[model samples]
Target: MPTAIIAEDEDLLRSELRRMLAECWPELEVLAECEHGADALEAIERLQPDVAFLDIRMPGLSGLDVAHAVSGRCHAVFTTAYDQYAVEAFAAGALDYLLKPVAKARLEQAVTRLRERLRLSETAPDIGRLMAELDRRLRPQVETEQRIRWISASVGDTIKLFPIEQILFFESDEKYTRVVSGEDEAHVRKPLRELVAGLDPEQFWQIHRGVVVRAEAIARARRDELGRITVELRGRPERLKVSQAYAWRFKAM
Candidate 1:
């Protein structure tokens, strides 16, 4: 049986797509339904679904952004309401898409193609080129201004700026998030959720709900006898717990 996840900001559209999938592809197990692109990306990494139905324009990471970030991982089926010019880009590419207010017949066609692709065990195509083109044409004035460059945190008596690149990991509680850098550590009022929006997905991976660690800082991952996994970091004594949901990152091949 195939597995999939749906991502659409609109409640009705998300539900409608799920209903349509059940109708057209009954055997397709929906691993998750995501209302935000960041959640969708995390779900894809965590669930390892066979297919992802992504909304082209999402709040934080757009569908194109997610597709590019997880290239060659899973098949992507974009759901778009782009102008005719942008729609033409999809038609000219190898990717599949369903227009907004997706018609049943079109979705059925997409389902059929997905089944065939899975049967053949086709490699997922890299969407870097398509994303660049689509991004350029869709949001010309938009740049990645949301990515955090610095974390201004208070030291003993003064505030210090930690470059986003040098940060090792972030652990959060209900009220505050702890920022650890190479030189020092500090606590801020922001939660992990809001900080995720500014952090680059490729740089910071959410190992646990309350923790986000730099991929480069990871030294090794060990699974205990109880089957729980923990991550050890370079030059750091603390071992971060990898939750079951994110344990897929260290799965044995």
Candidate 2:
């Protein structure tokens, strides 16, 4: 029986994939479920699983990096977002991949191919061509992605434009998104999800589903007795909750 490992950052997606894999390939024993690529790589190296399902974009090491490192040792099935350019790149390079919100039919096809590869005792294919293609196609978008330089939020009756650098953190309330900077705070009609795309990932990190904090503003992270981490800010009184999915960011290596 072929053993497998699952590596995805999101808890919900990882669980859904595990559940689906049981239904589609019951004989495929799952060795581990990892929250990040680093753990996935470590698990792969230690267990030597025959198949690995990896998410493309993760907190530390990317799925592509893990695949590159383990090219000849295991079979890789990439899980990526629904980007046409990335899909085209995967198709062009003949790499196996599943899109986010994976359909059962597509997953079954991927499973079939992997089973065939295992039957033939074939090693995983190298991904240089795919990486180069992704670098060419996605570089422009990543460069221009951080377009929100100034946040125009409402400060009571007056609308204030706060520089992106000035923001300490962003938290979503019931409806409005609260923008906090030191002692000052403002409300925005926009949701945190809509605002996340324009923020530079290097500068702002999504610690929680409803919380995004400026990296510089974080003083430290403290894990409580329950193993829950809350991030302390440099100047802010309120600490941010680090969700289980993102807890890998603060794990000590």
Candidate 3:
């Protein structure tokens, strides 16, 4: 029986996959399961599973990074929802990629492929070409309109949705992304990259990797003696740091 490990962040989806695997591929033994890339790496090193099911995107290290780290130790199957990355995965010569909300038929096909691979003594698939392809196309593409389709945010006991234009700035503090508007702030799950893709560049400038400030709300910009740049908002005393990458945007302030 081939040993395997599953690495994915979502709880319900992970449990569902476990159930499916147990039902469909009873001969395969699952050595471990992890919620993050870091944990997955540790598990792979310790258990040395024959295969790993990894989500392509995770909090700390990306799945691709982890796969590269554990090369030769185990075969890998990438699971992701985004279709654009499919081309890149193929270029990497990966074993297979299972799209999110995995279909039963697809899972069966993947199992068949895995069985065939184990029968043959082929090496793990090459993924460097795929990663390079991702590097070329993965940059954020700015959209023209300002809108918020769905929101994953908290407001007291209930989740709330405010239009994108209502947001003044996005501030990152520790683990959470705070959406500030007027005098209030709401916590949202969408990361800076996801948020930036939805926001219009003409209205929102990434003043710092940690911040996306509204273009109209910037009151002024000032530089400290040490050559550090800071921005002062209209009503907030807290100054936002301006990294060198975004220094050009502060010239107007």
Per candidate, the number of residue pairs that clash is 0, 0, 0
Q: Which ranges of candidate 1 are over 4 A from the true structure?
A: 1-15, 19-146, 155-157
| Candidate 1 residue pairs that clash | none
Question: Using alpha carbons, what is the TM-score of model 2?
Answer: 0.54
Q: Which candidate model has the greater lDDT, 1 or 3?
A: 1
lDDT of 1 by residue, 1-253 (tens): 8999999999999999999999999999999999888899899999999999988778877676566557648878888885322332242232476778899998987887777667556443764665555434433232343678999977679998899999999999779999998678899888776787677767888777688899999989999999899999888888999866466678771
lDDT digits (tens) for residues 128-235 of candidate 2: 565555435433231244358888876678888888889999999978899998868889999876787677767787777688899899999999999999999997
lDDT of each: 0.78, 0.77, 0.73
User: Looking at model 1, which ten-residue stretch has the lowest summed lDDT?
Assistant: 85-94
* TM-score for each of the candidates: 0.54, 0.54, 0.49
lDDT of 1 at 77: 85
What TM-score does prediction 3 earn? 0.49
lDDT of 3 at 239: 87
RMSD of 2: 8.5
* lDDT of model 1 at position 208: 75
Candidate 3 lDDT trough over 10 residues, lowest sum: 138-147
Q: Write the per-residue lDDT of candidate 3 for residues 1-253, one digit (tens) a residue.
A: 7889999998888888888888879999998889988899899999988888888888766576576556546777888887445434443335778888898888887887677666554443765565445434532232244345444688779877766776788987677788887766788876775676566666777777679888888888898888678888888777889865456555544
